[model samples]
Target: MADTLTSILKKLLNQPTAPFHEYHVRAQIEQYLLDVPNVELSTDAFGNLLATYRKGKHKSTPVWALGAHMDHPAWVKVPGKTDEWEFLGGVPKNLVEKKENIALRKESGDMAPWGFPVVFEDGKVHAAACDDVVGCAIIVAVFKELSRLGLDATVHAAFTRAEEVGFLGAWHLGKHWPFGKDAVFLSLETSRPVNGAEMGDGPIVRVGDRLSVFDHELINVLMRTAAEQGIRVQRCLLDAGACEATALQACGIRSVGLSVPLGNYHNLDDDQNIVSEHVHIEDVKQMINLIVALVATKHDGLGERTLEERVNLRMKEYKKYLEIGNAKYEEMTA
Candidate 1:
């Protein structure tokens, strides 16, 4: 499994410009999924890959979408230079050094990075494409584990494209997908340490993001489940960014985000940090356990609240956290 993850990471790094041109990565991941028996697969026009594992007892169970973006920021072609390049926002420099070939590309294209170095390495680069690839690996790992345990949940393993550009694929999936609004949506993305989701510690449960806040009841349930299962979890809020869950929450879907803390995000090269290396595998194991429990557990009196209502409630929650944070700061200073 580690070897497979390493190979996938190498492939993703090799194709740095994988936003809309992720056909190669898609093919590779599809092949990996095909190796799992009894799994069904499908793709959408937008290039979102969906893998389904059906349960015999819950044949009609509503689908729960677990997603991650398959795109990363890369230098796009500009007007003049054929071999010039710049760095994409949040890409780390250490990862860039791993590339064997360095070339400069033009600076006029849609994905062009402003004033940063555009790099082209000759050999495979494993670290650069891990921003979302790690998330992808997590989803794949979860699928494998579920299959091994013979669990039942109509789980949709989604790999979306063009998230770096503007969350385009997620917007489409959340708005028009055939799944019901009540279906739980979990976005596997990268998180930072400031929000308490640190690399090497455990997976993060995002309570709120820049785009939309997660469903409160679901968040509470996740927290409780994590506690009951002895899973290491961190509560976090993306102060300035969002993920695929944003679109789902907007569409009245009960959503949350699970992220592995990353270091050196959005910089040129991968020199920022090594926090992800510390993300304990045990944390991932516990996260998968919680997911399985959620799918298998049944409830009759779950409240029916609109997304707008959830958002309102989340805002209050955010304010409370902010106040607590402020008090802590004051205490430290005093």
Candidate 2:
């Protein structure tokens, strides 16, 4: 058989990177896509890497800007001993103290872990960085596939930075996102499992998170695409953590979040021990498939109205009946 996604996922997990310091991970992605002739790579002020892929012949209407943050929760070196550093991001301190085998990325790029593998595989590949690196890997894979297939469509994939702390990279990119105003921004993420979203249930078209709701039309577009393609998918309001979509939407961009349900989110197990985070390997694979399907879907296929808008229109259609007493229900008859 071809190479298992497990192996590819492990490679992505082992790429040591920290917030505001995503050079190594970004370089790895660049190397992966170096030979993709249709792709042009560039960097922004906040150190976000933007990969733009040009369509060859059958370009789809309305280009899509795919986003995935490059950084996850990691430790940053302090002024003390070179090995000593402050654990940054939202993984929780109680578990930080419980963390045993850990690793440090040295100045020259060598990593020394404290006895634990970057990933511990039982069934799924479990590691610390799956949160958004999975997002990065998925985007790069989609970009390459689009190029290799010669699918005529423009895709702007951005590997953003410092998302765990705050949406610093997205906020900066939002101010002057190079893809014109109409370009749809769809963010990919690995979110804590909950809210009807489970690891093996396929990718989720996020309705919203804790802070704000996503674009209804965009969510509809993804769901409609999955349906037409017969791709397994779930829709949920993933409120466990906010994603980059919210930050970009704040800038008046039409943004939405697509996530894979993650186990042991942020590496905090049920007992609060620092352990491996995982998503169903199939979830990762299906997410990539969904990305390609969504991009290929035509604007007309997505429909012109949001689900909420369509439902409200139906309610309005019968408003006259309620006013005039149709007598269809006991309340109306009374």
Candidate 3:
């Protein structure tokens, strides 16, 4: 499993990608999934890639729809100009202006854009596009592992584009609504660590982002699964930036988020150098492990509890205390 994780990460992270220019990343993902059994791939009208994996019987009523973007911050060539260019996506402005050395694509390619080279050493990964490419890689690994184990489950994954520029791909998909409304969406991200989320601790069960709160039931399910499987995971609100989950949730879909804590987010370090983004290798592995377990056990058969149900349970527990308090108040009043 670790080998597979490493292989996918290398392939995806090495691809040249930018907002609205995710051709190479999309192509790599296609090549990787070509022979995976029981999986079907398709693209939405807006050019987002979707993969569906269905096998055996499903234990949960709502199917799982996982999503990740395929773009990173890069300088895009301005149309009708040879030398002029404009930056897309979120990176520190000071670092962008510095114009550090970027790793160009191996062969002659479209627009000839470049980014930071992927370097994996000392149990850490530093890459140009770990922001969401790692997220994309995680989805690929999950699909492959689930097929190999032949788990009875249904999972859909979306490799969306242009996330770095305000969730463009995600917003479009939400408008079209490809997956059923009943399906729950999970946004996988390599996010800036905030609110005590730390790299190497484990993957984070994101409670919410800056934009919106996620489905409580889904968060509970993810946390429960991690505890049950003994996988270390953090729970927090990664408000460093908004993710694709916020867009889906805005469209009225039940959405939640998961992340691997990132360092030097968007290729900008504390000193403002334009270097590769960083993530702990073990955190990536644990993210994969937790997602696989969630699918394999069909969310550990913990049926989604309604708000009323949760409140009722608590209410029942405190009812005797409420009665006792009422009697004491009545005696006082009399």
Candidate 4:
């Protein structure tokens, strides 16, 4: 299983991708999942690929849509200029000022724009585009496993575009909201670590991003699922940047986030040199396991315990003390 998962991730991480130019990445994902049993794939009006897996008699309510973008920060060909290329997405300007041997083509005669090479070595994924390609690989693995097991549930995997520029695909999907308001959107990402979150610790049950906090109930659900399955996971706010969850949440859908800690983010090292981004192999594996566990767990009202219900439960122990104190105070006043 580890070998198979690694192969899938390697294939995806090797695909050339950039903001608004995710054709190669999308094609690779389609090849992985197009023929899986009990799964249906379709491209939305916004060009986001949506794959739905359905099986059995019982279905999990308020469906789970695992989402990840297919693009990373990379160079793209400028229009009408044979030799001019423009970089897209966010990479520090200081790092690219002296662009000398920074960009390398993967193969002879490969016509894709400038990007770093991809390699998986020493139990780490070194690539020009690990930011969300790792996230895409996770979704593919989860969907394939679920389809093979034929779980009595329905879930969707969304491969979005242009997340590096902005959450453009997600924003459009949310505005249209094909799955209605009952679904929960989970944005899977490979994010720069912050707030003590470290690589190799495990996948993060992300609490929030720089923009806004995620759905409270959905966050509780992820935490509860991780605990019950004993899957080690970190919980933190990756405030260095925002993810697609912010876009979906703003559009009035319940959205949350999950991520693996990333190093040399956007292919920029601590010394501001262009290099391949990397992530821990163990963290990637754990994230896959955690998401599968979450699907098997029951979701009906799992994390919907209201604040009122919680207060009432605690009040049982403290109500008598409050009553006695109130009576003594009234007697003294009289």
Candidate 5:
């Protein structure tokens, strides 16, 4: 599985220009999904790959969707010579500068590296494609784990395309598909700095995003589950960026974003900014645990609690701590 993860990352990095060209990254994932049992796969008009693993003895149980965007920003080729393709400027400077054996396919569709140092060991180069590819890998990993454990509700995985280009894939899916109006939606994206989800820190329970706030009942369930399971998790909100969950929320679907802490996100000026070695297997394990809990609760029905309700519950807990501090102050005065 570790080697498979590496291979998926390498494959994505190799196709930096058009990450969603169907035959490129999509073909690779399609092949991988074939190995798992009880999986039904299909694609939408907008190229959103949907994989469903039905759980429960009956098919009428509520369905849950786990979304992850598979597309990354890349330089698209304009009409020109194969070797003379213009740098259309979507890649981060750090990736372009540090990329080994950097290649380009011009409007003619011919491929050739720009002739720098082509870094190919068994064959792989470091690049920015890992941004959401890591997310895709996590979704696949969770699916495999859930299948092994035998889940109870139908768990649907949607690998949407064109997330970098204004969340086009998610918009289409949420608008057209029947994703269950009340289904629990979780988007696996990259987390923020400092308070972000670290690679070894376990799965992040995102409280809110740039677009919309998560369902409070779902957040509380995840938080309580993590605490009880002794899993490391961080609560965070991205200030400058957005995820597929944002688009879903805009369409009135309850969603939350989960991310593994990433180092170099969109900033391309410095190679050091890129995540060096933070990706850890332990974090992935905890993520699997959270997914399992959610899948197991298919029959429990979506909780009636609201975001305000959960916030008040937290405030009550905080008040106790405040009272302790007040008592300490009074004793000191006496």
Candidate 6:
């Protein structure tokens, strides 16, 4: 595992956080970023942590965002039972029944990655909130490296909330989006293996999912970056469920998704036991490096090529044939 990633994940994977109750996780993020120059941190009205880098860029340069949901499937609240809270999000009943060693969020105290513990073994990282904490942790890692390198890119990150239920936090930010309308947003994820997606095969440049198709331009840039830099990648449409990118796109932000294939998605094991969700450590590391590649590469005229420039130029190659053939065919027409 990358040292920076390991350090961040170990500290974050154990926190009793739920939608609208993400103070602990937010605190950890803020503390880690306090000394990071050229960055500003703030929360939206909905408590979505926003990290915007102040790096310089030109009009042609890309001003984009990388994001992940802050909340995962969790106990709703545990007031009366004193320690037992009702389940929230999309864990099915059969899986809930399979849980034998379910720990109380109260007992977790500090280490509470929704409900499971962080485990490292055989080049894999297993934890309850690996779904998007992996995404969130990578966001921190990307921002740190980009700031250090001072890439000529304007990048920002939004750690959203309540995506497991619906993209509520994403919606709230969209209403008052600080990133300009033209900014491309990429939703980082840890998705289940599907549509040829697999663990340890490197991260995916998700084209779309159950909700809607993503922006083609952003997807192309990501794919080209990975290929040019030799970062292993897969292209897939993970339709199992909708992600935050879906909500943001619905709100009119140019958005797409990227992910590392996960095991035990949402912590629902094959036999329905509540267990740790896992992902390849190398996949995580590569995804971070790929993002740096995205920021470092210039896209000066990427989207500027007009339809005429592409199609009309090809038409010219055959223009003389049309001219010469027309005169010869006119006699036949008569």
User: Which model scores highest in lDDT?
Assistant: 3
TM-score of 4: 0.93
**Residue 107 accuracy (lDDT) in model 5:** 28
What clash pairs does model 2 have?
Answer: 101-114
Q: Where's the lowest-lDDT run of ten residues in candidate 2?
A: 107-116
Q: Which candidate should be chosen as best, given TM-score against the real structure?
A: 4
For 192-305, candidate 1 gives per-residue lDDT tens digits of: 556546656667788888867887766766666677667778888875577889887786667888776655555332444322122334444555666776555553334345
Candidate 6, residues 1-334, lDDT tens digits: the string is 3337788887776655666566777788887776787789988888899997667753224567888987777765455555555666777755453445344233343223345668999999988778677888888888888777766566788999877778888888777888886677899998986988888999998999888989887887888778778898999998988888888888888898899899999877787666778998999999999988787667665434555687888789889998889988997897
Off by over 4 Å in 2: 1-7, 57-61, 79-84, 98-123, 301-334
Better of 3 and 5 by TM-score: 3
Per TM-score, what order, best first? 4, 3, 6, 2, 5, 1
Q: Give each model's whole-structure lDDT.
A: 0.63, 0.77, 0.84, 0.83, 0.62, 0.78
Worst 10 residues of 6 by lDDT: 104-113
What is the Cα-based lDDT of residue 135 in candidate 6?
88
Summed backbone clashes in each candidate are 41, 1, 0, 0, 2, 5
lDDT of 5 at 37: 72
Candidate 5: worst-modelled 10 consecutive residues by lDDT: 111-120
Clashing pairs in 5: 94-268, 101-118
Task: Report the CA-based lDDT of candidate 6 relative to the real structure.
Answer: 0.78
**Model 2: how far residue 2 lies from native, Å:** 8.9
Q: After superposition, how far is residue 109 of candidate 4 from its true place, in Å?
A: 9.4
Ordered list by lDDT, greatest first: 3, 4, 6, 2, 1, 5
> Tens digits of per-residue lDDT for model 3 on 91-186?
655556653433332222434334557788999988877988999999999988988888877888899998988999999888887877668899
The better candidate by lDDT, 3 or 5, is 3
lDDT (10s digit) by residue, model 4, range 1-334: 3338888988998888878888998999999988888889998898999988877755555578899999887766676676656667887655554547344533212224346666778889888789899999999999887876767777788899999888899998898877656578999999999998998899998899999999887887888788877888899999999999999999988999999999998877888777789999999998998888777666666654667788998899899999999999999999
**Candidate 2 per-residue lDDT over residues 1-112, each given as its tens digit:** 1223555566777777777767778888887777787899999988899988876554455568999998877767764567666666886666564535243223333222
